[model samples]
Target: MFKVVICDDERIIREGLKQIIPWGDYHFNTIYTAKDGVEALSLIQQHQPELVITDIRMPRKNGVDLLNDIAHLDCNVIILSSYDDFEYMKAGIQHHVLDYLLKPVDHAQLKLF
Candidate 1:
């Protein structure tokens, strides 16, 4: 089964995602969470999940930094952000992020991704 990692600074958002995501529908079983990019990178190195869903504006190493650091890793990435700035989108695109979801992501849409 595939493994996934979810990273966000906000406890509520992170918990909500963990509870809401339809893990059964996807070919993944293991789901992990990290508070920030620092923790995320550590988790990535250890678990090497297939997918990573991360918030952009997190404390202690943002999503972009994590993405850059993990460029050599073989995995898909989805960015979650409250800001809809083109620059952030552009950065995600540059790193070949699988998708960029705005805050309050739709459950249906997230399942599809």
Candidate 2:
């Protein structure tokens, strides 16, 4: 079993993902949620979850900064973005993210990742 952390500034997004995803089906045993990148980073450093799903435009520390910060960690990241910007996509590529899902994230798409 693995651990996963879901990070987003919005309460609905954080809670929705946590509840909607059938994490156990994907072999995830522990699930954690964070309100922003700052808290997410702390949780990442502490728990070292196998996976992280984070929003791009968060306060405190944006997804780009978080990606850079976790570049050395041995965890897979899936970015959640509301915008279809190339700059963000470029960053995700540079950091070797597992996948990037635009918001109103598609559950079927997420499962494929």
TM-score of each: 0.95, 0.96
Candidate 2 wrongly placed segments (more than 4 Å): none
Residues 1-113, model 2: lDDT tens digits:
89998999999999998888888889998999998899999999999999999999999999999999999999999999898899999999999998988889756779524
For each of the candidates, give the backbone clash count: 0, 0
In model 2, the worst 10-residue window by lDDT is 104-113
Give lDDT tens digits, candidate 1, residues 28-70.
7888999999999999999999999999998999998999999
Question: Each candidate: RMSD to true structure?
Answer: 1.1, 1.1
lDDT of 1: 0.90
State each model's CA lDDT, in order. 0.90, 0.91
lDDT of 1 at 88: 88
Angstrom error of the Cα, residue 74, model 2: value is 0.5
For candidate 2, the per-residue lDDT at 42 reads 98
Q: Return model 1's CA RMSD, one decimal.
A: 1.1
